[model samples]
Target: MEKVKRKIIKIDEDLCTGCGKCVSPCAEGAIEIIDGKAKVRREQLCDGAGFCLGVCPTGALTLEERETVPFDEHAVHEHKKTLADKPEYNITMKCHLCGTTEHDRPLLPIKAKGESDWVCVKCIPRLIHG
Candidate 1:
């Protein structure tokens, strides 16, 4: 197959902490934590929507145009199916406080002492600042 220039997710290994925050935001299941680092499992599976970019606290993920093989829809479908078959694959991310699964707003990481949790952007002031 001939390579073409297209947008794709790029991860900076030096910046990534492998926190697994970006894994759930990716609807395509293209991102995975391997060897304590975030990796793009398959280029074709990434739609380049950049949803994962929002959840990355370390700013390790970004989109860039590069020459690569065209996205394969068949491969994406297969990859999704494979992920779906796994019992641990969860698509919904819920707020740690309100127990709601809605993610329409940006999420913020709140850390106190040695523990950390994610709060939706709407709940930041009420939950953290207050």
Candidate 2:
């Protein structure tokens, strides 16, 4: 595996907010949210095409000519396959009432007054008692 100077995505961690807004537009799945920041997960998967650029709100992503591996279409397809095999929405929900994410507590799906929402366990007491 030889490295060469080529254009690749440069993610400025100082500006990235881990919003995950730039993840989807990258058809190659080259970028991902890691530890509350946007990261270039694999240099080889990034095509340096800047397709993920406009979706970024923070202007944290940029293209620069640097020493890196060349883009590989094979790796991108394999990466997408691995992702597809995973359960859908494993990242799941946020409490509709207070924005409490399931990352903090379990979210239960419920409906009231013809509206449905995901509510966290702590919020359940308030919903029932109020």
Return the top candidate by lDDT.
1
Local accuracy by lDDT, each model: 0.78, 0.77
TM-score of predicted model 2? 0.64
Against the true structure, candidate 2 has what lDDT?
Answer: 0.77
**Per-prediction count of colliding residue pairs?**
0, 0
RMSD of each: 4.3, 11.9
For model 1, where is the 10-residue window of minimal lDDT? 108-117
Write candidate 1's Cα lDDT for 22-117 as tens digits: 876677788989999999877888888887776787778889999988888888788888787654357567667765665565665565554545
The total of clashing pairs for model 2 equals 0
lDDT tens per residue, model 2, 10-126: 999998888876776576777778799888878999989986666577778889999999889999888888776443213446788889886788766665763445688988998
Residue 48 of candidate 2: its Cα lDDT? 94
> Candidate 2, after superposition: displacement of residue 110 in Å?
36
- Model 2 C-alpha RMSD to native: 11.9
